[model samples]
Target: MNFDKTELSDEELSRYSRQILLSDINYDGQLKLAQSHAVIFGLGGLGSPVSLYLAAAGVGKLTLVDFDSVDDSNLQRQIVHREANIGQAKVDSAKQNLQALNRHIQIATLNHSLDEAELLTLMESADIAIDCTDNFSSRFAINQACLQAKKPLVSGAAIRWEGQLTTYDFRQDNSPCYACLYKPGSHQELTCSQNGVLSPIVGMVGSMQSLEAVKALLGLPTLMGKLMILDGYTLQIRTLNLKKDTHCPVCQAQS
Candidate 1:
């Protein structure tokens, strides 16, 4: 579970030089990424690009969690999987591709579904959590776990021509958790399978999720406490403020 490298190699420096050059990142921020661990839930549409960009950005370790297998129908937006990976466990498929992307980073695959206890255990060591799952059940579970652990979370969703992004920096006292936005049972599962989707919309949201994760990892300013909505059809991006529900069950209990 601890695969952090002590230093970046010459090859890694060259691969990440463009980002390292940023005043916000510089060498210290890149080093922060090299020492961070991000646990990601699900390996479907949103997860695909989130994991890829995290690896390409040099996140030291990734814990990919999912129980489903790749299907022929997933190719449209699940960029991490291909025709060759059909029928393969999603976590396994994602691990294979992530390793291919960055051998220096460690990829850990959880091929089974996680119970609440299991999720809390896995998240204990994660610097951040990424929610890419398609259902409210998984999102609530991840939110609770991250809140308990005081870990940051980057969440993304996409359907049709719209994409949504949010971050919960649970380390902050006043930050809003997912439960602050949608309570349990308030959501009816609407999946891409039936709701329909545009491929690039999911990819765009996932990429933004990756960007948020990187910024969090580097201790830079991020979208925490804010919601970003992307209207791919109109090519418009909107940012909105969010307030924590003082009565939110999960967040209220944190105090």
Candidate 2:
């Protein structure tokens, strides 16, 4: 549950009545979700579903950061953006769509690139950070910021027929950051623009990220320290244990 007591209005109660009926997430869990704030980076394929689901599920506030604009090619997997918004900034387009989905939720947009300090500053105010970026550089920066801010991070990635999802809860001493999994300069980044990802692959990963984010906010079990890999070609999903790197430059000192 959230630290402060958050009351749900009659309208909110009605809107979230379906989820509230779950045994695991009753009224209290809904309240906790309503009090949580999530910062999402990249408004592309993975971010589309993550932001939409979080807003519809009643996450109180969302800070959307993306420097790119919606493109004709993005419509293939970026469901949150429409053809009409092709020239508009991704963050602005996403914010508009999210507001339409849940008027009660607050949505903020950052349509420019963020440096290390800017990312850290944004993470400090967020309860959790969601990384839907497609590049390694962006992912590394987000990982470092979340680690320093001590905020949980729900990260998802997809390319071609493969996708991966994981969580790093910086509030925990044993949680492994993205750096623990991939050394900063060792791995090459893949992009859908070049590799061509299947639409549903990104959707699957993003949806799971939304679920993990809600679970993290409600103090429930999440994908923390576990990497969930999906092979869209064979439709096989596997979970692997993610260990902390003792020499990780990002989280080793914190540990």
* TM-score between model 2 and native: 0.96
Highest lDDT: which candidate?
A: 2
Once fitted onto the true fold, the runs of candidate 2 whose alpha carbons sit more than 4 angstroms away are 1-5
Clashing pairs in 2: none
How does each model score on TM-score? 0.97, 0.96
lDDT per residue (tens digit) for residues 121-239 in model 2: 99998899999998899998999999999999999999999999999999998999999999978987777888898999999999999999998888889988899999999999999
In candidate 1, which residue pairs get closer than 3 Å at backbone N, Cα or C atoms, i.e. clash?
Answer: none
- Across 27-104, the per-residue lDDT of candidate 1 in tens digits comes to 877888888899988899999999999999998889999999999999888999988999999988889888888998
Query: Candidate 1: lDDT over CA atoms?
Result: 0.90
